[model samples]
Target: MSHSKSFSLQKIINYIGGTLIFFGVTYFVYSNWLSLNDFFKIFSTLGVALAAYIVGALLYLNKEYDEVGSVFLMIAGLILPVGIFIAFKLTELITGINNLSVVSFSISLVAFLLIFFYFGRIILLLFTIIFASLLFFAVMELITTKLNYFFDDLIAYQLVVLGSSYILLGYYFDLIKKYNLTGSLYFFGVLFILSGSYFLSGILSFDSTLWKMIVGVIILLSFILSVPLQSKSFLYFGAIFLVLFLVDLSRRLTPFFGEAGWPLILISLGFLFILMGSLIFHMQKKIKK
Candidate 1:
């Protein structure tokens, strides 16, 4: 086959495969809509598996590097089923075990180590560690039956953990620069930020003063970092977060400013929105140029 013909064929295959995978994930997620907890487990397992297969198939069809593609497909196939099974078994075990906390910790720890060995990537390894650490703490909470500082602030804990995980994953992508892998990393980064915001809100629980300020700063910083990385999606998302932060800040300081606080805050937010929007637009133009 001529090189041009081969490239065209590969592109077609990639397009078709990607469309199928997208539909499959949409079906999976839509099937369990409105029930996040019930659907997410199944969606993640099956969706990831489908995505992996599609990616592998695209790579194979492209004939760019069949060997590497095969490896990726195989890993995806293997991990999807196995991870789901383990999750189910762990859920069952957690129910039966007298020391549920210890069981959870041990399982997460093992999973962490296994991912490190199998993936053999520093970025993935760090994510595994963060996941394990969160699980460890969650288990500890269960064991002690204490809903004290940490448990009381589940949102904060979840945000910090998930956000940290994404930051690490993003760092990893920055190092590797593989197109597919970088796409996944960016997806995860956006997800973490959105989830982390909810967590921050939960932690604030009416006392939004301190938490709002902290999260605002975090959101601004996240936007700045994403710009240089050429992640328009994250930059835009961060801009949205910046608005939310300002709104929260204004609401918190309402007592001092009285009725004027609302308009002032909105005006401030409008300015920020324009500023960040301009920055993102300029950054993207620069990259293209």
Candidate 2:
């Protein structure tokens, strides 16, 4: 197929896959609304493995358009299912095998090894860092017996680290027209931001009042930096952060205003949305001109 035709087909496939996945998750959640914990326990690992396989298959099918990393992802897709199944069986047979941690560590390690083989030293190094971070968390959880706190904190730290890596990677990819890099950057950046928000919320457990203000300030600064970047990707990031900031601020202020605070929150959200939309439009027009 011609490049354009191939691109169009890939786009269609992606759209279909995304739609199906969304509906699948929604259906699953709705069906098990009363037993959400059980639902997650049964499906979360399997769901992730299945999704990875689908993604890898898609990449492999578009091998002509994909790079070495795509091939690696395909390999990962294949290995994930097998790895999970093996981990499950091993845990069942063994005296003290934690299936969840083992499966996660195995996948991360395999991914690190695969990327190392394909992309050389730099990518290998990056994957190694990711793998090690995950491994450290898994080991800590296994040893400490009450390492949930450490695990939670590590999760937040990983988000910041990984998210920063994505931004940097995306910057370089955008500069060089590397589509894979662009996609990776966007995916990881969003992951980082959302995870960071959750992490901040967790930190607020100690002192809600103080941490709320600090998080709000940090998020505001992030939005300011993102908005001025003149990049669609960055603008989107900024908009998300702005929305999160507004939500956080509203939640914090609601107690002070009692019932009246609800309307204030709605108005705040509406205004923020309008401001972000206008900013994005203005930026796009400037880019066109």
lDDT by residue (1-289, candidate 2, tens digit) is 9998987787667546645654564566567756756436335444555555456445545555454334344334434444455445544643344446655666666765764565443434454545655666566557655444434365666567667666776677667764444555555675575557556565324345555565566555554554443345545665666576577667767889888889978887888789878876776654422
Candidate 2 all-Cα RMSD: 8.6
Q: What is the TM-score of each candidate against the true structure?
A: 0.53, 0.54
lDDT of 1 by residue, 163-254 (tens): 56666767676787642355455656665666565565643245554565566676667667665666765666676666665565566667
Q: What TM-score does candidate 1 get on C-alpha atoms?
A: 0.53
The numbered model that scores best in lDDT is 1
| Residue-level lDDT for 10 in candidate 1 | 80
Model 2 / residue 18 / CA error / Å:
16
Which residue runs does candidate 1 get wrong by more than 4 Å?
1-150, 176-180, 201-208, 253-268, 286-289
